[model samples]
Target: MERYVDGFVLPVPTEKIDAYREMAAEAGKLWIEHGALEYFEGVGDDMESDMDGMPVRTFPEIAESSDDESAVFAFIVFESREHRDEVNAKVMDDPAMDPERPSEEMPFESGRMAYGGFRSLVSYEK
Candidate 1:
């Protein structure tokens, strides 16, 4: 079956990686609880691509990260497009997921975050 994905890239301050990891773990739990098939968040460790004549920019370049910042790439998978919509609605309504709720300072700058919904064209699992 085809899948749907919501992807995000954030430029996070290097000093805040530990805080970011804690926040991501909590968010991942909420997403899974709300019916997301998978919730994955990764920090850039091998972002430096030295491939000669590469046609595209690397993750760090695309994220416009500075020396003090690291690229954070995250995605939540769903069974299908409709399922994604439903799950996201529920997740958004849950108060625990609200960013506005009184909490610790955000680990990353929200303005620089990039996000989009993608239709998975080719999915293979063995």
Candidate 2:
């Protein structure tokens, strides 16, 4: 089973898109170099509510009325949670993961950035 580091980022504002993209790109490379199998990112999209009042989507909806106009979703896959943690430790110590010296102008204030890790439970592939 594969493990993944999932990031749900709500940008501080639309102006931060460029900076956020740069940060993600740089982080992607570092993760890959540290043994991540894959790294990917995407912008959030609006979705319609389902009959049961649930949103029909794989990703979360971006909050309206937010100072930030967009959200960035990203993840890196690893063979297992153990491998994921190992690579994460390396990334943290790589001198490239400094939050203070971000590669680009961050969209949200650094203190607001949010993230978490997840393990594959059930997967359906074509």
Candidate 3:
């Protein structure tokens, strides 16, 4: 199967995780409603790594999260880049995604978030 994905990494205040989760859940529904194949929001549980001698950074280190913040890694799946674009366009147009939503209501700083689109290299399904 071929697939495209939009991924994100961000830091969310630990005290605001619940609020973040609530917002993310609603957004996930919107994505799905607009034709996303899958919408996933993951809050870090085991973000640290003992890579031993390997030279690599952990999610927390990469996101520059503080002791009072947690790293969030999320992704949305689509059948293709075009499909992703279509779904995202619809989602963007949805009233629930209105830009008027106050930034303060979000649990994380939008400027600090990282996002990207990727084409599938390998995909499998059971």
User: Compared with the true structure, what per-residue lDDT tens digits does model 2 show for residues 1-126?
Assistant: 445555555444667677767877898899999898889987766434565876454333433325346656667888788898898889999987776865355555655456777878875545
Taking all chains together, each candidate's TM-score versus the true structure is: 0.92, 0.73, 0.95
What residue pairs clash in candidate 3, if any at all?
Answer: none
lDDT string, candidate 1, 91-114, tens digits? 899989766755448888788899
Which portions of model 3 show Cα errors greater than 4 Å?
Answer: none
For every candidate in turn, the CA RMSD to the true structure comes to 1.6, 3.5, 1.0
Candidate 3 on 82-117: residue-level lDDT in tens? 999999999999989879878887789999898999
Report model 2's TM-score to 2 decimal places: 0.73
Candidate 1 colliding pairs: none
Q: Candidate 1's error at 126, in angstroms? A: 1.2
Q: By the TM-score metric, which is better: model 2 or model 3?
A: 3
Clashes of 2: 1
By TM-score, the better pick of 1 and 2 is: 1
Maximum-lDDT candidate: 3
Best TM-score goes to which candidate? 3
Clash count in backbone of candidate 1: 0
